[model samples]
Target: MELVVNSPLQNQIVGGEEIVSNTSRNFIEANTKQVTLEHLRKDCIIPVFAKDNESTISHYQFVQKTREIAQDLFPEFQVAEPDIRISHLIKGRIPSAIGKPAKELLEHEKTLYYERCAFVMEIPEVVENVNGNNLALTIGGVRAYNQENLFSKKSPEKFKVFIGFKNMVCTNLCISTDGLANQIKVTDVDQLSFAVEGLLQQYDREHHLGLMERMSRYLITEEQFAHFVGKLRMYQFMDKSEQKKLFPVSLNDGQINTVVKNYYSCPNFKRSDDGSINLWKLYNLFTEANKSSYIDNNFERSVNAYELTNNLVNSLQSGARNWFLHN
Candidate 1:
């Protein structure tokens, strides 16, 4: 596996049918507005009360802390600017605003804090070629309204962080178990920074790349692909306990439908002439479909995509009881 340092890959992966070049962009992300790190730090309002403390981690602070720790940990690589997507505005009048109430005023006049935000920062200098596409080192975070009560300004704020690869061809993020922390519980910046530092420091890049490399060698025929898709759609309605045993992939019905569609029509990652798809392409399709997810579910699904693919490869190699593959 030859890694091209300083590859032409940039801020986004080349998505859909765009010319597959060194620099690729991503497919459009659903319900997200792309903003710079500076925009979030300077323009976004923080959420807190006058007399009490905050349980919420501001979008800007989360991104900044994660980015800073990542840079400090990987001193050899140059960190690019953070690519942030935010949605679900919490709009209201600021205590200092003098005119009318924010809702009464124009939409632009409100002091707003984003209730949901996700971002990816790539270290372009560290890169490798997988199958034919290039992947760069990428780190990202998700701040969403979830069961974790991520939006509450209480104690024990939670954030989802991941370290992985960004497909140069499109916005597909490649995350593995060694690189993802499903939830980081912290009360302040120091705790958050410590968590990020630990994850980056301990990430197994070689093992992660090995997992992806193994997938490229395995193939699933069209018949198996169809059966697998049908079973997955049904698995969602089954009991939760059953899903944990048979198919634990973290994709929604909408994301699965996108996989079915892309299997037939996607230019870069679709099936082959023999109507068979390799696991590598199959994995990328899951990630491509994941683009339709809102800010909150984005990272969770991305992390799941890689683990699912790696697990599938393990199933093929070891003959495990993964009905998602054999059945």
Candidate 2:
């Protein structure tokens, strides 16, 4: 019997929902706050509830409950439903007998793990021996800005009451645009857990570290001195580590001069140590190159230097005994 081999395209084909991929593409450019609450409630989260066997409810279980309650309370807001045993729904697979350890389905899954603290309700509420210490109603806070004081004072926003679990306010309703993120006001806690959990999970999953990884590569393989300078300035100025992880590419001499001139024209650049040029700081004058632009000849010298350094490094990684063996 003869066997036929398939082409690379056919052999490597993988199946997945095209709609989900297209949907996630839009999600990539969106920030946490910009994402719609309805998407969080419907697509991302699940609902969870308290059970008779208190021992069965884990901390992660609590977070799931919070999400569901938040969704149920504000159904119109498009919150996620509460999910009990949401961890089980995460979709992971055990390693094959001859292969590696457990493998998660999604490489970039981010989840909120929560623990139960307490439950608060009116006289009709049921009391169960849960792990948490305190429970209270989720009341909206009035945080009005006082111009003279420059600080907002918090007063309870009446007409909204929900349960507090592990210092987290949860509700069985949806949040309108006006509702506070922390304070969930709903009639049913069970429904809120699903919505809240879903939104948070969706946000975490949509935002990956691709930009940071690309930037990191640029830092290690700097081709132009000008690019490094621009990158260094951006790196130093950024407050978040994730944003800084994006490495700047190599820049040419002309690009370096343009950046310098731009800085000189700015008021903030004059007073800052970054703007002033000294011989010691001259080495790092240039920063990243714009990949989309036409290639410049500045990288010729950098290429030669890089080749020499790479040869030495490659030799070291390959277990060359003597330092001068390939010199």
Candidate 3:
């Protein structure tokens, strides 16, 4: 079936332009125009494939552009080699012989699909003294695959760029879903570097340092963690208000609690010696949960969870500030 996008933003952007057709069976064809991060969020159309003779950028080019932007922004800091990985979605077929060896059964594997690509580059670590102990600030940019699948009718295959931070002390990576500030979509090769630089500018030294200081000073208490979990549970049962528009479907209470449990039990999420949690830990919990929780194997569901959790964290931060002011 030919997939159709029902987004108003997409219609506005296309504006009666002819969509270039492609021969790839699973690929969706679209115009070869440059789209901003705003366009990606609203339109849900990704311009990954271009028409014949049209210039297109590869994943390697994207990494190079990111490195250039990082160098330009922080000349003193060195951009390390990017750690690259690929995800493969495969369908297993029944083996002809039931008793066949595992190695021989592998030959019967029918199809392997290219799911997505991801890469992370670590920036120069910042050392700070926190209560007579040295803490390292690990900052980097993460590029992950966002694309259309059988379940996702609106969103298309595109790469998403995120600026992430991790304090070695907590070993938790903090990510935000504020596309307007922290995220960007790669549409045009020419605009890739500019888009990355723009995100970096938003998280300038002063802003980044302030957040680091706040996280260092405020240790999350058991009460605060409970409050954050309560907010997530509220999302599960909240009325079909703004959330309905954002999430395709609300997560149930069981699913919410399972995610919370995973956060506390996961070995990767190490708690501080003081037994206090922080925003970084909370943020990592959601991101890690998204990695494992797949709704009917639909990629869109995972993406929605990631975005929802990010917004939740942002709200939690605002609530914390308000509490501090009142007390």
Candidate 4:
């Protein structure tokens, strides 16, 4: 995917970088002044709230809030309708005999309990790129089911927000990070704007222009890319002396080898004319491989892939920045 270098907000610094250095205590103290929902909505944040006289909100309400928030945030950008997924935990004994009547088994089960809900929205053509490719990011808010299933708890239901970038060319989210930090939880409904602002601030601090500048200027040799791959493998698979187990455990060595072989054989593995690969290309390979290696249908597997890719990209970018600054 190509990098987006000309975003309107590229030059503007919405929040100062120094805020990140302050302790959480100090940061909260400084931002503790009551912020109204109107002000937050102006910042493109739609705070979720229970319906009148109700303590909890329905799944439909959560998804509608996400759609509202995305529309407010990127009016020009194409916002896909939010997809809501609910996971249910079935607690029941397995049928004693094979091919037992499915309906009868369900009758014996006590209940299907709610596990969690994820409200996901796709923002297309957002102005951020990796390796010259246009990238889109997904914003999702998740709420877990509890006893009240509503706002019965004293503290507000903290929706865990995920902000991830998608490769426009490949339509893959393997390289997307959670803005700055992973798993940002929104505890105060009123302070949603501040929470998002803080996340963006942290991202700017960590992924400031210096990193991009270095990527634009430097390229790594094939050997260097190989070394990086080794580092990445160690970072992800190493577990105290052995590689971690691969999914769908039935796969033999030859099957695993074929998957790895095919991945490296892809066109993304090629180097540029300078006899060195651009950091973006190298990073993209990892993300592509991450997407291919995991079981795509499983949400947990997808999340793991995203996290792994995010960490690898962050680490590689940091290393590149250091290499350029010193060398």
Q: For model 2, how does the per-residue alpha-carbon lDDT over 1-327 read when each residue is reduced to its tens digit?
A: 111222221121122231112222110111101112232233332322323211222333333355345545545554322221111112222233223332332322322211111212121122221222122223211111111121223222111122221111111111112222334333333444443444433432112122111221221112233444454455444667654344322344455454465444522212134433321112112211121112112222222222323333344355654222321
Full candidate order by TM-score, most accurate first: 1, 3, 4, 2
Candidate with best lDDT = 1
The estimated TM-scores of all candidates read 0.84, 0.19, 0.51, 0.48
Q: List model 1 lDDT by residue over 218-322, tens digit each.
A: 988998898889888888899888877764777889889889999999999999999999999999999998888877667777878887888778887877766
Give the best candidate by TM-score: 1
Each prediction's whole-model lDDT (CA): 0.76, 0.27, 0.43, 0.42
What TM-score should be assigned to candidate 3? 0.51
lDDT of 4 by residue, 29-135 (tens): 21112121222223221112344343344344445555666677667888875544333322323335235543454433222222344545668665465556666
lDDT value, residue 118 of candidate 3: 43
Clashing pairs in 1: 13-24, 13-25, 13-170, 14-24, 14-25, 14-169, 14-170, 55-153
Model 2: how far is 275 from its true place, Å?
A: 23
Better of 1 and 2 by TM-score: 1
Ranking by lDDT: 1, 3, 4, 2
RMSD of 3: 13.9
